[model samples]
Target chain A: MLRIGLFVVTVIGALVAAAPLIAIAGSNPLSAYRALLQGSLGSRRGLAETLIAATPLLTCGLAVAVSFQGGLFNIGVEGQLVIGGLIAGAIGAEVSLPAGIHVVVAILGAALGGALWALVPALLKAFRGVHEVITTIMLNYVAFSVSTYLVSPGGPLVSKTQPSATEKVKATAHLARIWQPTRLHLGVVVAIGLCAACWFFLYRTTAGYRLRMVGANPTAAQFNGINVRGVVVRTMCLSGALAGCAGAIEVLGLHGRYFDSFSPGYGFDSIAVALLGMMNPLGVAAAAAFFGMLRAGSVLLQAKAKVSKDMVTVISGLVVAFVAARVVLERRLESSASRRDRRRRDG
Target chain B: MADVFSINLVVSGIYLSMPLILAAFGGLLSERSGVINMALEGEMLFGAFSAVAFTWWLGSPWLGLLAALMTGALIGAIHAWLSVTLRANQIVAATAINLIASGLTAALIETVWGKPGVSPSVRKFGIVHIPLAGHLPFLGRIVERLTVLDWAGLLLAPIVWIVLFRTSFGLRLRSCGEGPEAAASVGVAVISVRYRAVILSGMLAAAGGAYLSLAQVGVFQRNITGGRGYLALAAMIFGKWRPVPVLGACLLFGLADAFQFRAQVAGVNLPHDLLLALPYLVALVALATFVGRASAPAAIGKHFIKD
Candidate 1:
């Protein structure tokens, strides 16, 4: 109940903060918000669009959450996703196979690409004692640069005819559409399935238990004979694979091609989503959907309300800040309460 | 002509190094005080935006620099409050600040200036010439062309080294980073010291951002800092949290940036993106190869608990 209350408060606080900005932009906050709702949920098409946007975010959220569970901060999700998507795109355009096989191959390619991208940071953290945060962040720029080069005019992945993007993926590689009016595809179902799979992997499996044990206390885990180093590297690889799938899904489901700078910070946004959802799969799904709605609605907010799409970024940032602040506040309260209880007993 | 070109390259490199040294110095102050300031990027961005915005409003680059410092310090206080007082995850708190700054600055730019892409150009600091020395042969050419801001920024390294190593306040700050419990036992207030250090750090970083906007670009773009804050953090690590070494690292990065720009001007056939990626790639390589085993403050990311 407290969690629900906090969530409501955060949402309200973010909206309130955004209200003035909307007003400054010469739009009525209430009407603009109403338009946002209408844009994201008023029609079946709008709902489908929301689902489409949420799909990759859910996968990326899972990626970050899984790594967080392993006590590793994976800031390379953006790079991993980009590399994975590029591999998927290349495979989709070049390979010829049956629909099922083609899709599987492309997805696998994406997973491989992401894993390769994540390998450097994982090794550095596990063996070399390097911090994952900075390395991962650095890799993000490297991935961006490499991907851009590959898709640019002289790059190998660039289409002969279209200079800015890779060639179209084969029809067989495309995720089949579930909703006719919208871009909703099998990617959503796959994303959900992956979320369920992640939940199972984290909760039910012995390896998962070991990974969590390491995260909880690395020294204790080591004393218990757990191979802490192996777990760290493996956990990163698994997380990277999930992020890779997010990239592949985007290419296979919606764009059907890979272009430079396709994502507008979806990978980074997933970190907040994971935190907001308390690192739970179901919670991540809900959080991703909420953000997805805001993103989907931002277009309408821009079009009808004359508000800039950047306003959504401000709102999301506010929500993230508020959520983090609440967690910190709650912890302080708990500590203080315990302290008070001890004092009373001692007295 | 090549001599002039070389001089231009060196001067531009120094110009690029100015913001980095300031921001990295800020990182150093916070880290030395046991607070991991991952929000340097956000602080710099806010500083960059505020510097240009204030400069436009006040029509004075000096006042704009002051505004940037205050804004940076204010954001730093928020970060210190979240990380130190609330014991929030420092990384998460910093990330929040980055997002908030990115969004809020962009929104403000759009709402106030009516343009989402870039802000209006503002008055900027002028170039300086070391009067007598500027007339000398080799050094004169480069020294005469350096901006006033660049000279001050370069001088900051030695100043920070002195403050961090020579002062009693610096001792307390270092003690907090090394062992807060020990610091607290010795009649030192760990929390307040950290707060002050972080806020001061933010102000210094804002000076870096102001240099970017008012001294370098003369206008604020959405991401004017452009990961230079992170580069500064990398430099901090590369310097092993010391002022002098960090200055050298910043200079190296600046030189890479200067080379990229010069190459672009020379119409080099390399992909533009590749050229842009050079500095980041160099930092990554440096981090992995040379700085992998670098030592950090003992209690850097640890939350202090009053037991």
Candidate 2:
């Protein structure tokens, strides 16, 4: 019940805060919100766009959620995803084989790329005692530079035709679109499947239990004979793998080629999504869907209301700030409620 | 000719390092008082945006600087409320602040300026040559070429060192960071000290942002700080959280920035992306290996919940 209240408060707060900005942009807040709802949910095309946006977010959110469960904060998802996409893009363009084999290789290559990118930070944290936060953040810039280098003029993977993107992946490797003329593709199914798989792995497996144990209490887990360091490293690797899949799916399903700066901060946005979902797979899916709707609707809002699409960013910021304050808010509410209960009993 | 070249390099390096030095000082205050300031990046962005906007409004870089400092302080207040008072996870709170700043600044730029990418140029801090220094030997020439903010940053470094080591406030702040419970037991208000330190940090960091817009660039763009805040944190770690050492670290980073610019000017013909990424790559290497050997404050990032 408290969780429900928190969610409601967050939504309302976001709306109220954004109202003035909407007004400043010469649009009524009510109509602007109505446009958002109608655009994202009122039509089939909008729904398809929302699902397409949600697919990568789901995978990225799962990546963050899994790492959180293992007592690691994998803020390097952005880096991992970039590297993963670069590898998949490079392979997708170069390889021309049977569809099944080609697609598998590209996806696997992406996962490996992500894991490799994450390995540096994990190793630093596990062996050298360096904080993952700074290392991961530094690696994000490295990933951007590397990706840009790869696709830039005079670089290894520069496209002869487009100049800023790589050659298209072979048709055989392309993930088929589920709906004609809409962006939704087989990647959505793959993302959903991965979500279920994460749920099973986290709750139904001994390894998952061990990971959770380490996350919950590292010293206690170490005392209980768990390889805490190993869990930390492996969890990051798995997390990177999940993020890599997000990049690969987006490429194979949507863009059809690798380009520099393809992701518009999906990796970063997923942090809030993971938090809102309580780091659970099911919750992550729901959160991802809601964000996807926002992403889909926000563009229409921008066009119709003449407001900058950047307003979505402000909304996101408000949500994260409110969510971060939840600990204090919830504690206060619980204490007041308990006091009220005592008074009623005494009376 | 070589003397001239070297002097130019050093001057440009100092210019690049001023913002970093200021931001690192801010981080030092917060961290020295037991508050982890991961939101330095966001605070710097807010500073940069407001500095330009205020300068455009008031036609005075001084007022712009004041506005930037206040904006940074406001961000720091939010961070303190979450991490100190509410006892939320410092890192999560900081990350949220960064996201919020990124979005809010961008939206604000778009709404107020009717543009999406960059803001209009504003009143900037004009250069003032030191009268006697300008006529001196090579060293004097170097000093004369430095911007007022650059010299201020240089002077502020020693001032920070003195304040941190010599003053009663510094001692209390360090005690809060190193042993919050002990400090609380001994009648020091740990929470209040942390709040002050964090707020001070925001103001200093905002000054850094103001330098970027008002002194160095004369305009604000989306992401104008461009990870300089993270670099400032790296500088703090590299300097072992000391004011003097942090100044040296910022200079090192500034030297790298200067070198990158020089290489570009000399037509080094490197891949644009590789050259653009060199500073960050250097930062990553420095952090992963160098900071692992440095010891941080004992009670850093730990919440002290009083009964």
Candidate 3:
């Protein structure tokens, strides 16, 4: 019940915060919101696009949620995702295998690539006690540099026809489309399945309990015979694998290859999505869906309402800010309720 | 290869280090006051945007600098209100600030300039030759063509050091960071001291941003701070949060950047991308090997509640 209240307050707060930005763009907030809704949910094509956009966000949001559950902030999801996409694209282009097997190998390669990218920070955080935030952020730049170098002109993995991308992924490796007259693919189903698996793993397993204990109180968990360091490493790798799958699905389903900059900060946005979802798998799906609507509808929002697509960014920012300050709101409500109770008792 | 160590390289290195130095000091002040300020990047970016936008509108570089400082203060106050007064999670609040800065700046560029990504060139600060420094030895060559902002960046280290170490206000601020509960018990206004530290930190960081748009580039570009704010954070950690050492760390990074630029021009047998990644690689290695949380302020990242 409290969660629902928080969600409602957050949405209202975000809209209130974004009203001024909409005004700055010379558009009425009401009409702009109407256009946004119309563009995202008013038609079949819009709904399909929203689902398509949500696929990676759902996967990436799970990745961030998993890390948060384990008391780690895996900000390197962006880097890991890029590495995963690059590996998946390369495998899809270079490997020769049967249809079903090719896709499996490519995705596994992507997962391994992402896990390896995260391994350094995981080990650093677990063993040396180095902060993952700084290491992960630093590695993000390294990942960008490495990815750019590989696809640069005359560099290996550069497509013959396109200087800034890898060769197209083989048709055998493509994530088959599931819907007609829409770009929806098998990846959305996979993302949903992953969400279910994540929910089960985080709630129904002994390992999940250990992970939670470590997060809640490391010293107590340590004294209780939990392998805290190992759990930390494993949690980070699991998070990275999920993040990698996000990238792999984008490559295999949407883009069919790794481009220079395919993601429009989806990994970063997933942080906000995870937080807004209160780190629950189902809640994350809802938040990702909402954000997906914003992204899918942004094109029409810009064209119809004369607002920049960056308006979505502003809204997301406001949502996160409000969510962070929810404690203050909750405290105020509690104080007012308690005052009313005291007054009734006196009467 | 000789050009790698030339007077030109040293001067460029100093010029490049100016922003990092100022921004690292900003991190120093905030962290010393016990508020984790991951919003340095956002504050710096907003400052950069304000510098260019105000300069373009008002037609004066000085006013642009003033505007950047004011906006920095505004951002600082907001951040303090969220993380300090509201007792929100500092990192989450900072992340929000970053996203807002990025989105607001991008949208405003479109609104104000009718274009996206880059803004029009505006009036910029000119070099200020020191009256006597130009006549000195090798140091003179590096300092002679420095801009006024550059000098301010260089001089801010000692000023910050003195303010943080030699003043009663600084002691109170450090005490809040170390033990806010204890400080409050002793009649110190822990909350207000943090607000002041964070606000001052914002102004310094904004000055660093002003240096970028006004002194270095003469224009505002999208994401122009380009993670330099993070680099400053890394530098602060690398310096163990001390002002003078943080200045040294910034210079080291600045020199590395300068070397990378020279190596690219000199046709060094390395990928340009790898060269671009060098400073970050260095920072990562430095953090892994030398730094730990032991040296950090005892009460950093904790929200203090008063009854």
Candidate 4:
């Protein structure tokens, strides 16, 4: 019952956080929400756009969620996405193969690229005890710089002299769309499937159980004979792999080619979505869809209202803070309960 | 021409290092207190934007710098509320600050200037060549070229060192950071001390941002600090949360940045892309070495709730 109360407050916080955006829009905040719901669900086109926007977010949110489950904050998803896309684009433009093979190569290449991006931090955290949060962030800047160079004129990675882009992927390599008009594609389905897979991996399997135990209490897990060190490295690796695949999926299923500086921090934004979702894979999917709707609606909101599109971001931030506050409060309540139990037993 | 290039590189290195050192020191305070203080970048943005906006109005960069400091303090207060008093997840609060700061600054710039970005021309923070320092050779030249902000920022290290290790307030701050329970037992007001430390840290970081806008650039860009806050935080971490070491880390990163720009200008055939990756690479390498087993204050990143 208390848990339910916590959940209600979480939603209320989200609503309150979203209030400023509506006020800025000069519409009834309820109407603004109605428009958002109507805009996204009013027609098939709206739904498609919501789903389209959610596609990358769902993948990225899961990527973030996986890391949180492993006691690591993999905030470098933005960097990994770019790295994966760069590799895929580098390969996608050059490789000549059957459409299936070409697509597979790009996807696999992107995943590898993302994993490689994660490797440095994983190694650093595992051996050097560097905090993943700090290194991954620094790595993000490096990733951006490298990606910028790759896409810039006279860059070794891409012909920088050209407009900031790489060669488009082959037509055959394009993702099959669920809707012809909107951006909805195979990646959405793939994202959901991956979420299910992650759900299974974290909940159903012994390895998953050990990973959760480690996340919840590393010492306790160690006492229970769990290979804590091994879990840290492998779980981080797994998290990175998921993050890499998110990047790969975005590039292949949507953008159709890798390019430097494509995502406007989808990786980072997913962190918010993951938190909102309570770090559960299924919850991530739901939160991603909601966030994606707001994202897709931002342009529309701007076009209709004079409010700067950036206000949407402010709302997102407030929501994240509120969610975090809730998490902290919940933990405190749980610990207090346990302490009470301890006192009762002692008495 | 070669000498000119080297001189310019040295100038640029210190120029870049100024704000970073200040912000990292600011981070050092909070990190020592156990808060991650990710909002440093946003606070810097607040400083940069407010400084540029007000300086343009008041016609004095000094006033602009003060405004930036106040803004940073306010931001620091907000962070303190969320992360310290409210006991929220530090990263969530920090990252939220980053996004909100970026978005708010962009939006505010639009509202204030009636332009999307790069605010209207303001009084540029001028170059201050110290008369005495101007006499020396290459080394003297670098010192002479330092701006007013540069001098103030350079002095921050020793001041922070004293405050963090020598002063009573500093001791209390560390007590809260290293172990809040012990700190509370010792009669230190753990939450209040942390609030002071983190807010002061924000004010300092804002000064860094002010250096960027009021002095470094005449205008503001949406992503102006461009992950420098994170870099500074890394420097703090690499410095292992120590004042002098944090300064060292900032200089190291500043050097990487300075060299990268020089290398780019020298126009070598080697991939400039690689140069771009060097700071991050250096960070990874540094973390692998010094970051290993680096002990943090026990209560760092964990909020102390009174039992």
Q: Give Cα-based local distance difference scores for all models.
A: 0.86, 0.85, 0.89, 0.80
Model 4: runs farther than 4 Å from truth? A1-8, A21-35, A156-162, A328-347, B1-5, B271-273
Rank candidates, DockQ, best first.
3, 2, 4, 1
Q: In lDDT terms, which candidate is top?
A: 3
Better of 3 and 4 by lDDT: 3
- For B103-170, candidate 2 gives per-residue lDDT tens digits of 77876787778788899888788777777877778788678777777778889888888888999899
| RMSD vs true structure, all candidates | 2.5, 2.5, 2.1, 3.0
RMSD value for candidate 3: 2.1
Model 3 residue A145 CA deviation (Å) reads: 1.5
lDDT of 3 by residue, B200-282 (tens): 88888888888888899899988788778888888898898888889999998888888888889888888898789888888
DockQ of model 1 vs. true complex: 0.58
Quote each prediction's TM-score: 0.95, 0.95, 0.97, 0.93
**How should the candidates be ordered by lDDT, best one leading?**
3, 1, 2, 4
Better of 2 and 4 by TM-score: 2
True contacts kept of 3: 0.66
Query: Per-residue lDDT for A218-262 in model 2, tens only?
Result: 999999999999998999899999999999998998999998888
What's the residue-level lDDT of B82 in candidate 3?
96
TM-score of 4: 0.93
Query: Mind sharing the TM-score for model 1?
Result: 0.95
Scanning candidate 4 chain B in windows of ten residues, the lowest lDDT window is B1-10
Provide the DockQ value for model 3: 0.70
Q: Name the TM-score of candidate 2.
A: 0.95
TM-score of 3: 0.97
* CA lDDT, candidate 1, residue B101: 75
Give the proportion of true interface contacts each model preserves, from 0 to 1: 0.55, 0.69, 0.66, 0.69
Interface DockQ of candidate 4: 0.60
Query: Which ten contiguous residues of candidate 3 chain B have the minimum total lDDT?
Result: B286-295
